[model samples]
Target: MPLLRARPALLYAAVSLACPEGALADEREEVRTVLFGSLDAGRSTFVSAGAKVAPGGIGRDGFVTLATLGYGLRPERDWWGDPRGKAGLTPPRTLRHTVQAGAVAGWQWVRDWGVAALFAGPEIAFEVLDSPGTRKLPTPRIGARVQGELWARPTETTLLTTTLIAGTARWSAWGRVSWGIRVPEWSAAYLGPEAALYADRTGYRKWSLGLHATDFAIARLSFRVSAGWVYEEQIRRPGAYGTLTAWLPL
Candidate 1:
């Protein structure tokens, strides 16, 4: 389970943290693929895959304007039954299967240790409810969504990232911020604290605080991993959460 697994699907409209290390530093045309998954208190899970297309090897004066064509597939589930199973009580859990699809023209500006980006697009979502708790099904829908991101290295060893999404589609309506202090010997990696807030029409609202390590590199992949405490207004009690996000360039 992820201490920060509460990465709701709405955030995947998503992938707001663009580490400079994976943004095609080579100058040739490239696609930056992202794979991420998150889980909380041994219950909910979110998995998403998306990509950004941009030119490699950019900027000489530490500043450049770029556009990336981006799209993603997000599939997720939230189990609303049984709390840590006790005794012989095995109850069928209420679950939600949600799939989201969307595309965006991503605009970005990278300058020195700071990056700002914007993306907007049309999104559609299909949801299936296996909730033995509530025997109701909602209609499918679509909407235009916009997302904004800001990442900065305020000092040589500390980093800040903030993301906001608004509009339609199950979530594009959340915001998250993370702060990182660079590790002693790893230049591209940081360990820090993260906070997030999410809300929706379905009455699903929650908040979390966790510890995270961002932009850890293993060969061709850059990874972000988190784990922490979460409190959901809809859930009976606070739960454990965590998430893993990886980026690959090609």
Candidate 2:
């Protein structure tokens, strides 16, 4: 998916939101923070840090919020302006910097259902090329997401999320249906999948498919993986990426 190309962060969010759960209720308040960094084989590097503070488990009357910032050291810019095949041509230099901020707030119900609002804005700055004809450009996106859970259980959760974007420029509107499954308590594993569609002024903008997984490797350390595929017109880019995070509970 075009999104899979430049927006790996959202894919991480999908898995992060789906994987964690509560085993026993704790009366004391708790704060958990995670910091992680990754370098793709393509020579792009990223770093992000965030926290989740939940008074009542993350599923009940509390919120889960995170903010992430990253840049691509040698980014291929073909996926920027046009998702369709029309923009197949890539920029001369593969370097770009990106800044992103996002937040999500919600009221958890009975440890299963939830209502939340999500807002995110990302700005991109392309490195200038030597050739005047290859001058750089800027791209920014402002968007919001409204999500609600329809059914939830100790072992599974289902959510319907809708996203809208509007800014100094035009963007895409999309909706997603996501489902998660928890492994047997003794195993401590999680898996989730999501399907989404985007629409624009032209027509069906893009269709995306995503997957998430988490496994505990040792004490206070966990592994996370996510990947997605986006289809727009005759172009398709399926990207696979993820992160491994270690947690410190304070």
Candidate 3:
């Protein structure tokens, strides 16, 4: 997917205009850990765990870092085979394994009303095909990503967020806007619409509507459930997927 390539000057200008004075005073360092999983028909099962740390503390005004590792199990038919028929017929329903590692470094600014973050990083991925008579070598790819996020609270009970992500390996651009309603006891519900454009070996465009609910009943822990339907064009395949995630502060 193509990475979001908006000029950095514009992003900085937007942040300066939207944030108020109070946002800069209280910065502290923190850590967040997340575990998430998703499954889609005819696709694959995906699972990952990651952590983000602000070593200088939240209000310190420095760089934050993130690291994550993930694995995927895909159906055998999804594997690529030799086109000359020299590899013989394709194997039965087998499974392919993919492993990925990613890292990010970004600066964040916090204001009383909201926060803005900008980051750019590189990712490395490897895939292992498991088919009969196929070599077991891992295929590797390297890519870069640029992302930005903004959160604004226009009222005590309402919050708005926007996110943009772009990547070179897959050549895709994605953007999302969401509104959340904060209830008592730190619980919230949010609804968002997202759009993505991908240009790769097989190109496609996708639009999705998603809903998320979160509960912070336990100290330092949060649980979330989200679901969405994706309408895809180009290849003409539509799909739905749901995810469950847990957030822990460590």
Name the top lDDT candidate: 1
lDDT of 1 by residue, 71-149 (tens): 2222222334344344454445355666666676566665556666687777777777665445567776888778787
Give the clash count for each candidate: 13, 2, 16
**TM per prediction:** 0.72, 0.50, 0.66
State the lDDT of candidate 2 residue by residue for 1-250, as single tens digits.
3211211112223213332333223411232333343332223334545454444444244454444444433234343343443556643433434443344444433322333433344322223322334445644655543333333332222233333433222233445555555445624445677665555433424566777554433454445555566554423344443334433333
**Regions more than 4 Å wrong, model 3:** 1-43, 74-96, 129-136, 170-175, 185-207, 232-237
TM-score preference between candidates 1 and 2, better one: 1
lDDT of 1: 0.57
lDDT for predicted candidate 3 compared with the true structure: 0.51
lDDT of 1 at 38: 33
lDDT of each: 0.57, 0.39, 0.51
Ten-residue stretch with the least lDDT total in model 3: 1-10
Q: Candidate 1 at 189: error in angstroms?
A: 1.1
Candidate 1: Cα lDDT at 167: 56
| Candidate numbers sorted by lDDT from highest down | 1, 3, 2
The predicted structure with the larger lDDT, 1 or 2, is 1
User: Model 3, 162-184: lDDT tens per residue?
Assistant: 76767665455667666656554
Worst 10 residues of 2 by lDDT: 3-12
